[model samples]
Target chain A: MTADTVQSGLAAQGYVASPDLAMALHLALSLGRPLLLEGAAGVGKTEVARALAAWKRCDLIRLQCYEGLDAAQAIYEWNYPRQLLAIRAQGDHADEAKLFSETYLLERPLLRAIRQPIAPVLLIDEIDRADEEFEAYLLEILSDFAITIPELGTLRATTRPMVILTANGTRDLSDALRRRCLYAHVDYPDAGTELQILTTRHPTLNHHLAAQVVGFVQSLRKEELEKKPGVAEMLDFAAALAGLGVADLSADPAILQAALATLLKTQSDRAIITTEVAQRLAGKAA
Target chain B: MRGAVTRFAARDPGPAARIAGFMGHLRANGFRLGIAETETALAALATTDCSEPATRRALKSVCCGSAEDWARFDAVFDSFWRNGGRVRTKAVPSNTTPAKATREAEGQATSGAGRTDASDSQKDGEADTGGEGRLIATRVANLRRRDLREVVSADDIRLAETVARRLGAALRDRRSRRVKAAAKGARIDLRRTLRASLSTGGEPFRLKRRRRPDRPVRIAALVDVSGSMQPYARPFLAFLAGLMRADAAADAYLFHTRLVRVTEALRDEDPFRALNRISLLADGFGGGSRIGAALQHFATTHARTHVDGRTVVMILSDGYDSAPGTDIGTALGRLSKRGCRILWLNPLKGWRDYAPVASGMAAALPHLDLFAPAATLDDLAALETELARL
Candidate 1:
């Protein structure tokens, strides 16, 4: 979409994206800068990457991190079997150049993201989860938008990919990685925005029903709950009611309890939510 | 679409169908409202063409309920959807009619902007500014993450006050052990001397140096077993006995409103049992703590007779004086001047706004040579190390 039309498209779908993000994105596009988003979990950290890729029509490349994640998994590693076969086939005839060229070049996400001709959205989720060593390795590539393999030499992004990094604050991220991109933190929506979100998600529900569900969920969060219902949970609860065809809280409390799988993960949370309090609001299920 | 209708009118197919369609749209566009409610809200939304402004406003209101919840949700929505989904509307040229442009620009700033793009108006007189900080606090205070047990649970590890007590007790034990080592001279061997006298026809009398008595160190812990120290009593005593095992002279004592020497009672290996025994031994162990009275009793009855300048006094209490406040301070001051290195550790001071407010704290605060925050296991360790230093 044209710059002028971007706002209208979002408005049509019921979103109120701020102008600062628009300006930051525009500058990022102009200067080829990556965007870094930091925030709490379940606050739509990855959604930004998903939404950007959709809006810009680019491929989304994700590199998921956990303990013990290493450079070979992120950058590139050679195919062992292919390399063995090439070595056997060549025998003494092949030198380092010939044997190495054919089979010893397997690419990982970072290389794949850069090597692709089409610009892709590279999402580094939970960059803070990886250890300091992994963070350091990520920095060289992030800062230069390239990778250096001893065999392959430096492979830079011919067209720099639009990168977005999301962290959940398990640990503080390195300043170097943060400096390479524009930073933003993604918190959840406010009461009014959440209401819009519910209505936007579940159109069949009445205003009173939607408002009540949001109110109840919000109240539940304040209580020392086993698990908090996020925006995702609210939507799931609302959608579950609409599917059951109940329009108010006065009917069908059981379906709300039964649909507990959508919002609550643990059985204990479901037990707490589906009791008398949930029974009161279950009439929203038509 | 024109005016208000009965709640029954919402059941009509045209509006319901439209609502259902919109719910589907919401799902497709990626709002995770539950399966049932998605359909319900859609049914409600389809009944009328609520103005886009009103609908958006209503929708936000419903989804966002708590001040804390909305702040976080708004931040996430702005960051993810805005950065990733559609871009913002283009600004009209700055050269456009100054009056209208300025008015529009001013209108946009006061709305609750999240994270990076808080409007100038919001930073000012708007409700969002003063409230935004609170919102951040509330939302962040309840983060949704995997239940990392250690991070979520309120640990029962030593608090700052308890740590200080344990540290002081440990130091006192160390000092008492040193004093016992010096003061315990050689014991006279009577049997050997008599055997020599028999050889010399009963007139000869000589004595041989014998092994000294292995008297262990005694730690008279004048701990305040008052209701105020209930939470800390268990941990503090455990730490006390654990420190004493390492020191040969350490004897543990506890008090509430009166003095009771529990040196023999808490000789058991298990800390909990030892504490229980001491609690039973002390008369005021379960009563309101009187630090002044306990100190006065120990000084008169036990000071020169049982305890002496060699004795290391360790006081483990929040310093709450049930007696007159001035007396508690005077008594503690006198006790300190008598060669006791007074170290006062308060737990509440570990908190950001903790001030010396309690009468006990006021009484004892001035006498403390070493004041520290001993709120956690680490703080206790720090307290121990400080004792070791002394």
Candidate 2:
């Protein structure tokens, strides 16, 4: 599909993707390459895969990466307990080839995505948290859309799934992995986009409150807090204000400071944005 | 689209030459574009609507490999495409000297060896001629090998920081407790093997084994910013920033008469800006050296949480103590009891006739696992190989 089509498709799915991001996705689809998305913690990198899957009307398979992730957990595993029961039931007639066949094979996210009849969206989240050696295992599947097992030889994809890998800059990925994928960097949405997102997500909310909420969150990000509130946090803050029936941000100082639990994550962050700072930000937010 | 694809094909020499020239310009500006990336960009350009902005965005996705490269893509694109394939000298300072840009581009391809040769040639050229060009080249070469105390130029400091960053990214991995499946391992994985025995009729036919995986080593550096170490503190802080970038778990602290953790400040994406923030944070700099009290403060406050057996505690100081009766040996002994390795990087050791006869250095010498000199960038580069052995 063209970039414009991709943009419209994602917009229908409520993902408001930038033109550059849409273009990157279109190139990745046309060229049959994996896309790598890097950004801050909560800039909606993972949401892109979900939106793409919804737009494509296909399955969304997720593989969350962490330290010491290995191929057995990511690609496939054998159902050993069932194999043993079959061997016991068969007694001397158990065949080795049948035991290791597809019937006894358990498919993980990677294998399940490749084996799908229609192309699915595969999301590898927080890839930087995995060890460097784990990246070497991904090279074969990413470039060739295939996985090699010693017992099963090689399994190629019936339909090559769309792959999206997200990293939060915890560590540097190897150059080989970076070279194999199309790249995009996602940043926080601006004030206009944030307001659009809020109104879209909560359609019944008042427009004036939505503008004030988005304004306050945007201004609060400029403060010297340890963790700046993200888009998701902004949405949560807005929901809390609506639930509390607070129309104006500067009207209730004590309630605004208490509602910061949805925005501020750490104790230090809460201490930084005191009542005075919140009121000042609310005054400017008007 | 078919006509556009045909026009951009190799058979048509005009667009092909332009694309190659653009790729060359990108490479000169430190974008790593190999043949695969070039082919992808060309294919993307041919199939899509050929608007200039769309083409630039498509090529940017294909070419950029990191955040830094992504940030630099637009400027490089404007310089080459908007300027009619002529890279403006004002936009890119590296392109001002064609020879230097070409040399750096070549150096990028061969990695480390080509850069060493480039620096060596500069030194050799300086020995032959007394011209202004040769003099500047000589100064650039000397900056890498000169003592940090003698370094004064901003350009030299920037170059040294870049080298320090590269060196820090080469940190070696250490074996961790987490295990992965292996053919032969130190211990048997009973859980996996038991599960595997189902195919064999409850018989343990094949044994499953596991071995420890490798993770990046934890590092905590405490730099002395006292009066005596004023000259070397900036360069050492640059090195510390590199380590923090390489491993996110790494911690950094600065101390004079008191200790202040600057890990959050040094975590800024810009190294120069992080150094400036750190300089403002450490208002106690240029005070009298209090190595003993600083060590005591770290051991009492932060050692329990940050230091473990896998950690390497690096103390960058000259080991000169202004507090006479303070106890340094006991403080080091407490850290050593935690099973962490302590390393001392003394800039004073670079002197030809320097000795560790100072009371503080003599008391702490026996507690150190490694004592190395860090007077120049070359010495810091050498420490990479030394750290690998650890």
Best by lDDT: 2
In model 1, which runs have C-alpha deviations exceeding 4 angstroms? A1-24, A199-212, A267-274, A279-286, B1-382, B385-390
lDDT per residue, candidate 1, A31-88, as tens digits?
Answer: 4556666555665567667767777678999999876578878988766556556656
Please compute DockQ, using alpha carbons, for every candidate against the native two-chain complex.
Answer: 0.01, 0.42
Interface RMSD values for all candidates: 26.3, 3.9
Write one digit per residue (lDDT tens) for candidate 2, span B6-29.
224356667666788778877654
Chain B TM-score (each prediction, in order):
0.43, 0.53
Work out the iRMS of candidate 1: 26.3
> Distance (Å) between predicted and true CA of A62, model 1?
0.8
For model 1 the TM-score comes to 0.45
Estimated TM-score for each candidate: 0.45, 0.66
lDDT of 1 by residue, B1-390 (tens): 223222334566775564454444332222234444444344323432465433333233323222222333343333222232222111112232343334334433422221132222111111121232334322322221111111111122224234535554556433222221111246555666677565334544445445433333344455565556655554555555554554445445565655555554445554343443343233223346667766665554344333434445666667676677776676666666555555555555677987777776787778766667654456666667676565
